[model samples]
Target: MAQHAAVDDLVKLLTKANYDLTLVQHRLDKEFQQIYPHNANPLKLVSRIKKIQEDLSSLKEECRELLAAKQDLIDKARTTLVGNRSLLKRMQASSGLPLISDSDDLAYTNLNQIINEWTVQVRPKTGDGKHDSDSEDINQLLFSAIVQNS
Candidate 1:
């Protein structure tokens, strides 16, 4: 009878330990979800964040390329003006075209006019703070800079 009681006590202890362990695991699982709800399925959330980062990086690269292209165009236009002035001077000397009083001044004026017209037509303009109904991704910070300049 004593041996039987001892065996029963041992079984009861084991059962209690198992129940406690299960309770602790359930509590831990709940805490884990609270801590990182999005990471409940970690692989999926990681992939989504990676894709968003890639898209932002691509947009930044495109903006850089556009700015570089604009700078190159400005430089080429300036070089063309210089070449045009030289060509005009040569023509006046050899072909007997009426010479301007100041060829350099005329060239500078023409370049300025061309640049002004190009800027007005090609540059993006920013309007008021009201968002456009059609466009969703307009960055307010960048648009504000454009507005101030305009």
Candidate 2:
């Protein structure tokens, strides 16, 4: 679950790297110039410096991609959570139950338990003459659900 640096963290890192690269660039130029007067062997080290720069560029791009993916996941999760809450509210209304508070409790709540509670509220009492049709309809729905699941 460990993620790469956040936007501000990356900014801070880039700031430090920029300063360090400035110093390193100046020193490398001075040293390379001093060495070049004696021989041409330092060209191999130039490739090494360029390699470091290329690696740094690749790393920055990777960090940016990771951050965007993390943000996209967060956006998707927020949308799903909001839709679930709306559905829960509608279920409460239909069941004639008091609405659960929109709070942290929802995170801990068992979805199955809430569904069972709603069914209990809506189900007709046993042996009640007035609700026989409603009871039959509920039974049919339950049977259909079981068949579908199978």
Candidate 3:
């Protein structure tokens, strides 16, 4: 009777251990399934990460190209403005007019006044008078300078 009772107690302990092990395994499997569903491909996660990095790199490259284009445009406009200012100074000197100082807003105002006077003088006084091509040339130069300054 003692031997049979010991065997029966041992069986009960083994059965309980097995049930606990089974429960733990099921819990671990559930957690794993939540992270990576059974129907989904795990390799696609790495591919998605790679695709995001590629998109970020492309966006940075596009920003660099746009900045370069804007800088090029600004440089060209500055060059044109400098050329126009130099031409205006030369015209003033060649016409025996005093050199307008290169400093201050007052100088620019004086230069504009001179240009206006020249334009007025160049126009034909009589309605039938022939237009001087020289006057037309000066008018075009003055117009370009005004546009550049503005």
Candidate 4:
């Protein structure tokens, strides 16, 4: 359970960090636009744009590492659970315990259900095409505008 909690926390932190980085980049782009206007020095603008790109790239790499760490934790937990369950089954068979219906079957089913629910809850949703699509479009527009201005 603690391992699970730790993985969940890490995922949350990574998600928040990604969001914050995006917001910061957006704000920086806006500021750059305001400061540079149309007639600003090309060399300065180019340098500033390169710096922002580098920062964004570094943030993305960090996000990817965090995601990979979270996945590794989850995989370790799953492997441990599977091994434990196999051992339990072997012990039960050796002890001549009343062979209840296959416990492993039930455990796997429950684990699958829990994982499905967790995935649904943690994933970001893309709403119906009308309203939510506008945000994505706006982001693209902003990105292009920044590149063009730079």
Which portions of model 2 show Cα errors greater than 4 Å? 1-46, 104-150
| Per-residue accuracy of model 2 over 1-150 as CA lDDT, tens digit each | 234447778889999999999999788777877877755537657787899999977865675555445445544655687688889889999999998775545562554355455355434333353333343354444444434455
Candidate with best lDDT: 1
- Write the candidate numbers in order of decreasing lDDT: 1, 4, 3, 2
Q: Write the per-residue lDDT of candidate 3 for residues 1-150, one digit (tens) a residue.
A: 999999999999999999999999788666766888854534555667899999977965664555445445544654675578789889989999887666654745565565446545434333454544453344444444544455
Best by TM-score: 2
For 101-135, candidate 4 gives per-residue lDDT tens digits of 54548877787677555344333332332332232
Off by over 4 Å in 3: 1-51, 96-100, 105-150
TM-score of candidate 3 relative to the true fold:
0.35
True-vs-predicted CA distance for residue 91, candidate 1, Å: 1.6
| lDDT of model 4, residue 27 | 82
**What local lDDT does model 4 show for residue 14?**
100
* Per-residue accuracy of model 1 over 14-102 as CA lDDT, tens digit each: 99999999999788767777776766645456778999999977876676566556656766877897788779889998998876656
Candidate 4 lDDT trough over 10 residues, lowest sum: 126-135
Q: Least lDDT summed over 10 consecutive residues: which range in candidate 1?
A: 132-141
- TM-score for each candidate, following the candidate numbering: 0.37, 0.39, 0.35, 0.38
Question: CA shift at 37, candidate 3, in angstroms?
Answer: 15
Total backbone collisions for each predicted model: 0, 0, 0, 0
